[model samples]
Target: MSAIGTRAGTGAAGWVLADSWTMTRRELAHWARQPVRIVVGLAFPVMLLLMFTYLVGGGRGVDGDHAEFLVPGMLALTMAFGLEATMLAVTQDLTKGVIDRFRAMPMFSGSVLVGRSVADMLQSVAALAVMTGVGYAVGWRWHNGLTAALGAVGLLLLLRFAMLWTGIQLAMVAGRPEMVQAVQILVWPVGFLSNVFAAPESMPGRLGAVVEWNPMSATVTAVRGLFGNPGGSGGSWAAAHAELLAVAWPVALIAVFFPLAVRRFARIGG
Candidate 1:
């Protein structure tokens, strides 16, 4: 009986793992079918990189190459900006009764959300690769070597992971596909209010202070440090401890939103 029970538990765990992988493949298959989305996503950030580097020109108070500062900042912004796509996908699935169909089936609970996040993270990696390639092509170089570059990329993806769950939770709460645009509008302020495009020292005293404390700022600053880029002034505790905050901010976001997303995902049918 003991051996049978152990085997049964192992089989159940395997079933859950299989279900999660199947769901992840379903989302990946969508990417193969809709290649434009991947291209458009890659193009938008590269466009921003070009426009800002050329049109907006270099940032004030920046040290060394401006592209150095802009590239890392753009990478961080890229991570934050893509949440709308995930939210739209979630809401669309909910609204079209696809989620209902899954809920009715004998699948592993929470596998859908898991799968969505997995596919989105993979897409995030592809976006990061494209952005890094563009950065190199446009004269941005990582002076700190490969390990640091990889670490910087890891932090950016950590931000993306947090944003993924946050978007998922919001989409689940919003309940309809139409709410995508509204949630998207809210995302803009969060993205713009950060120290992505300029130095905190360059802005007004109070607004600069707020921007310094922004979560996106932490990740960008940390990445700049890892890449040996220059932009941070580093007077405030937030600026001085950017790497710490970069990890803390995203971990806190995941801590709060991951459970909320999972709970909310499970609650949709009830």
Candidate 2:
């Protein structure tokens, strides 16, 4: 009897882990098959990075090497870019009845959503690595120590995780792939309103104040601080508060959205 109980417990644990792994692998395979989309997603940010660094960068009171200032902003933009892919995948799964099929399976019920989030984060990591390489090619370098470098990576990952939940929530609400485009339209303004390309001080007063406080701006400010880039200024409070806000805002967003996304996933087709 004791041996049977122990065996049953181990079996259950293994089954749960297996379900999660299977879901994660399935999503990863889908990405592998869609290499072109991945490339396109990555290329846009790199193009923007180059265009801003070489073209618009010099005119904006952006002191120091533009690539360095631009890299941090591009990092935030890349996270924003990832949301569309997540929303599209989730919406596609729902519309094609793939999610329904998963619901019918005996696998862990939450695994599908968890798997998508994991796969997307892996893609984000790859995208970040590629962008970092591109930044290096264009003369961006991290002047901070290794610890600060790692911290910047951590900030990016946290930001991606927060955005992932937001994407999942959007997917749940969208219910169809076609709706993702409409959702993506909202992302552009959020990206543009942030201090990504130029200093907030250069903007008109009211607009600059808003841009300085935008969450993406906080992230850019924090990353620029980490890189020792000089673009962050104006609103002395923001300059002092960027790092804490960067960490807190993402944490708060994830805490709120993760549960909402999970609950939404649980109610699919209900």
Candidate 3:
């Protein structure tokens, strides 16, 4: 009897994986149909990198080349910026009743969301690659070995994964496609409040403390260390433990939002 039950459970898990992969492929198919959207998403961040590196350059309290300071921060910023695209897609699906159709199918719960996230992560990796190439073109180099550079990329993607769920929850909450734009506008302040473009120590005292504690700031600081670039000049405890905060912040966000998003989706039609 126990063996039968174990096989049953394994079969159920297999369906879940298969269903998720199908949904992921469905989302990826949109790239071929809407190639321009993907191109614009990839290009916007490259434009931002060039503008900051040349047009509006100079990061206060940056110890070395500003590109060294800016590029990692920009990578972290890139993760934060494009979440609106995912949110918009989710809201569109919800409004258009695509999710309803999916729900009526014989699929595992939350598999659609899982599939959406996987697709978004693939785009994020593409964005990271484009930004990395552009950063190199603009004088940013990782002084660390390849392993450390890869670790930095890992941390950046971890942040993106957390942010992905948070956006999903918001998209569900917003419910309508038009409301996505309003909710997405809120993301910009959160991205800019970090030490992404400048050192936290260069800000006013209280604001500097706030920036230092921002999740994006934690990631920027940690990645800078990984890439052997200049970090913020802040002397606080958060600054001292950025690597810890970098991991903890994203994990904490995922813990809070992932289940919340799943719960929200589960309750949608109930």
Candidate 4:
């Protein structure tokens, strides 16, 4: 009996994985059909990187190369912004009844969300590569070795994973494509409130404290440390232990939003 139950659990897991892959393929197909969307998604952050590196110029309290400071911050910003795309896609499916159509089939319900996340993560990787190339072109280089660079990448993607589910939960609640645009605007504040373009130390006292505690700030600081970039070190405890908060913040967010997104998705059409 125990053996039978174990096999049943394994089979259920396999079923979900297979269905999720199928849905992932369906999402990738949309990328082909709508190449402009993918291009725009990838390009926006690159444009921002160039704009800041050259046009805006100078980082307050940044000790060394501004590119060193800016590049990691931009990567974290890109991850924060990636949620808009996820939000838009989820709400579009919800509004157009695509999710409803999928629900009519025998596929696993949560697989749809899982598949969307996988496809979004793929785009995010591409975005990071593009941003990294652009950063290198603009004179940003990781002083750390390859393994540390990969660790930075892992943290960036972990933050993106957390943001992905947050977007999904928000999209499910928004329930319409047009509403997504309005809802997504809220992300910009969260992005800019961090110590992305400037050091938290440079800000006014209370505001600097707030910036230091930002989850995005934690990620930017942690990634900067891993990449051996400037602006990673800080006097504050938040700055001193950024790597921990980087992991913990995202885990906390996922712990809250992943289940919320799944629960909300389950209630659709019920």
Candidate 5:
């Protein structure tokens, strides 16, 4: 009855928004049937936090308190670790023909990936909240004010969004559900090769430079600064400009992989 609805239906941007929301709802409905997956995803990072903080011992080159250094790093790592969900979801859908159904529906072309990104980001937010509570219980308080803390959370989610697209593209390339398991082996090295558990300075000469330059390390350092956490300072330019790289790295990644994933999905959809 309204021109607004008719206008929305007539535009590219509006179609994408409308279709993405519909697909987002589809993902939310799936969540009810996959409660165990969400729980495991959230719990896996917590287990890592507990293991490193207590059983494994303290982080190297962590100044002031190790737990403070740990909490921020773990937050960044937790955001990244959830990429498996995106990877598995994409690969499984590709194999099971779920994506084909969506493509056949006359929906907006990018809506499928957009919806998946939305669902994953929401799941990541819940995981972050759980992680924050666990951090507080472990005596990891943010010395920064509330605004800064919020900024830290924003940066954390931004990195996850970038990683989501990267994971989607990687999963598409792998082309099967079972290949995801092998692909997962790469996540561990990518997670650890950065400055997550240990400071770059503590790593050693050239290796430390590589660690400092890792895109994940940039976010960790940026968030650490925003949260007023410890041990983010570095001798290298990349580490020094963590704030800039935190923004740049994710933007660059999305630019590269977002289109790649869309094109790859097009192949299957046809």
Candidate 6:
């Protein structure tokens, strides 16, 4: 190849790596400056875990260690809560013209979106660690051993990645910071309407059936199964469907939303 061609190839490769790195570093720096957000994110679920396990988890006749039952549900909810952060960041970038600046720069087109997803995954991992440590402090145990524990973690990460894409797509569609709050109101219903805090069977007839099929419900059920937690409504369709839906739904969601998020990013500031 010509010397100019060689240089061009090297530059292209460097830009790809550097763009991702720059985006990641920028996100990390932003988090470092606003550590309170991370603290609040971790604390919110921990408080819910404590309240449910002590106040309602035991009194409701849910069998099993309450902490054990609560921990897996909290893990799933923690991931659901992270969507707000993703939406906020993406919206802020859009409104602040940061994305417009990125468009003018010579960088890999895919890097910003990929980097946002990766950084959010890392944040999820940190939140998981904090929540797990708190769970242990409150007497939760994993009787199913290391493999199952790792499997549960893997499921949580998969769910986070899928949700991150959804959040990004929402931010792109909304295109303003003010819209993030309106969008976030949808999260609570989607979360509480699931089996996160109670068994589907315990819900009212029609509501129970819908909760049984919720994607978050599938994840909570599968993780609880993996963790050997009790009160999972054994022998139901959810029990049978949990494993397949837990993996497949997230994969399918990412497959649908990821490309859409990228397309939205391309059209930003246009």
What TM-score do all the candidates reach, one by one?
0.93, 0.91, 0.92, 0.92, 0.90, 0.91
Q: Which scores greater on TM-score, model 1 or model 6?
A: 1
Error of 3 at 199 (Å): 0.8
lDDT of each residue in 27-133, candidate 3, tens digit only:
89988899998999899999998888877774333333888889999999989875787788788877776778887866786888988999999999999999999
Count clashing pairs, candidate 2: 0
The C-alpha local distance difference test score for the whole of candidate 1 amounts to: 0.88
Cα lDDT for residue 111, model 1? 92
The TM-score obtained by model 3 is 0.92
Q: What is the lDDT of every predicted structure here? A: 0.88, 0.84, 0.88, 0.89, 0.86, 0.84
Task: Name the lDDT value of residue 34 in candidate 5.
Answer: 90
Sequence-dependent TM-score of model 2: 0.91
Q: Which stretches of candidate 6 lie over 4 Å from their true place?
A: 1-14, 58-64
Better of 4 and 6 by lDDT: 4
Clashes of each: 0, 0, 0, 0, 0, 0
List model 6 lDDT by residue over 1-270, tens digit each: 545542344667788887798888988887899999878877887788888877786688755577887898889988987888899888887777566778886678778887888889998999899889988988888879999989989998899988999999998888778899997899989988988877887778888888888899889988888877764674568667897889998999999999999987877667
Candidate 4 residue spans exceeding 4 A from truth: 1-10, 58-64
By how many angstroms RMSD does model 5 differ from the true structure? 3.7
**Native-vs-model 4 lDDT?**
0.89
Work out how many backbone clashes candidate 5 has.
0
- Which residue pairs in candidate 4 have backbone atoms (N, alpha carbon, C) closer than 3 angstroms, thus clashing? none
lDDT of 1 by residue, 149-233 (tens): 8999999999999999988998988988888899888888888888888788988999999999999999999999999988867
Candidate 5 regions exceeding 4 Å error are 1-13, 58-64
Q: RMSDs, each prediction?
A: 3.8, 3.5, 4.3, 4.6, 3.7, 3.1
Candidate that beats the other on lDDT, 2 or 4, i.e. the better one: 4
